[model samples]
Target: ILILFFVMMAQMVVLTLPRAAACLNRAQQVLEIEPSIVDGERTLDDGAREPQDEADAVAVFDHMSFRFDDADEDTLCDLSFACRRGQTTAIVGSTGSGKSTVAKLLLRFHDATKGSIRLNGVDLRELTQDEIRGRIAYVPQKAWLFSGTVASNLRFGNEGATEGDMLHALEVAQSTFVLDQPQGLDTPVAQGGTNFSGGQRQRLAIARALMKHADLYIFDDSFSALDFKTDAALRHALQGETRDAAVLIIAQRISTILHADQIVVLKDGEVVGLGTHGELMETCEVYRAIAESQMKGGE
Candidate 1:
């Protein structure tokens, strides 16, 4: 009877081995999968660390184009633009026009299939991901926050940030609601900032990004949640904070980017217009139509 019992136990163990092997193979395959973009080996020297010319372009897109591996057509086509320090560059377009892709390309989230993107005259492909992202502060369309105190979330941007720094950033972001909380900066935040309203979460996220010292500031539709008054005031205040850095605003509302130094109008992944509000109205029919449509809608 004991020998028969041991044989049954051994059989059960052997039966599980095939399933375990299959699970191990699946895990191994996931582990072996290569990252989409490889890190570059080049390092920046001390001289290359700082921009020699203040008037020089901070980012240059040289006829860049991109297409997903499964897509037949390019998402962005021969896009060329330059963002300079101390100036605002805005990209606006209808849905599926590839407005946000420009920001992703700059962040090196995806590599261009054709042409090149350069930062401070250096090709983006030649720099490591960290090196490229270190000089940029980006706020994505969706604002997110971890479960922690407001101060803790702000510190995620700059570990050494003082209370004063946090206050200034909050003030500039038009996030004074934090001050009304019982504990102010110590106010507890729920995961993903679910405790706060959409607009409040956006303001907090903006403040966090502001805490970082960056040469380029990218706001990807970050102002969508704010009221018109708040949006205008925040932009007004941002001028002071970003006076020394390049500002890139990706927006759908024409009012959000009407005063941008350069407005890039994209239609079907191509630049249909490239100029200021006044200039585009006169030159680019696509831009004029968009502006007119928005005005009619009272936006």
Candidate 2:
């Protein structure tokens, strides 16, 4: 009996050894990699401008362009736009048009290859990454939720948020479904929120972002999982909550951004059209074609 027990333990060790070694190797490889983005010497409080003249427009992208280190050419070219407080700026294009890359640039994932991106009249390069990210509330394309209670996840955005504040944010994000759960805010969330539907996860992620009072709010394809009615309602509620901040949305569906204050149309990593949806439909062949294609598909 003792021999058989020892043999079983040996078999288990042999089975686990390979996985343990592989995990260690991956960890070492990650530790060895040098970071491409480094912290700037300046903080947000150092040499910041008040934006007195352009108080409404908080973030300005000035002729910005980016090319990956191993890529053959630029991914985004000569992109210029302003995100104004109390207004929505939506970017739309076919896949690989670099709409998401714009968000990455703003998030400081990669430095721009050319031109400049400024926040509050200060260049992005001049600010520390932490400071830059602190001013922006971002909902990524993939709405990832940690394994915890719903209220705990929401508090990740604002550690000091009260229950009332969280409830308000959930309402703004159209995540009132949480209130229906057995434990409400205390409901357990499985890792990656696999327990919830895609739409529910997206709404919960939006609520998390809303908990933060940021100067800029970015939703990257966040409403794609929702139906039109819910999307419209969420946007309406969002407008009121974000009245004092700038909103940037990256979307593929035309209906999602149809009412944006400004619509930026991209093609082949370049800005092909910059105007409202109605204006783009009149003047931009690419925008008009895309709109027509989606409208026909819906029919």
Among all candidates shown, the one with the greatest TM-score: 1
lDDT of 1 by residue, 119-228 (tens): 87788888899988888999999999999999999998999999999999999999989999899999999999999999999999999999998889999999999999
Clashing pairs in 1: none
- lDDT accuracy of residue 293 in candidate 1: 86
Root mean square deviation (Cα) for candidate 1:
2.5
lDDT of 1 at 28: 100
Model 2 regions lying over 4 Å from their true place = 1-32, 50-53, 296-299
**Over 4 Å off in model 1, which ranges?**
1-18, 49-55, 297-299
Q: Write the per-residue lDDT of candidate 2 for residues 163-271, one digit (tens) a residue.
A: 9999999999999999999899999999999999999999999999999999999999999999999999999999899999999999988989988999999999999
Q: Estimate each model's TM-score.
A: 0.91, 0.88
Per-candidate Cα lDDT values, in order, are: 0.92, 0.92
Q: Listing every candidate in turn, what is its Cα RMSD in Å to the true structure after a full C-alpha superposition?
A: 2.5, 4.1
lDDT agreement of model 1 with the native? 0.92
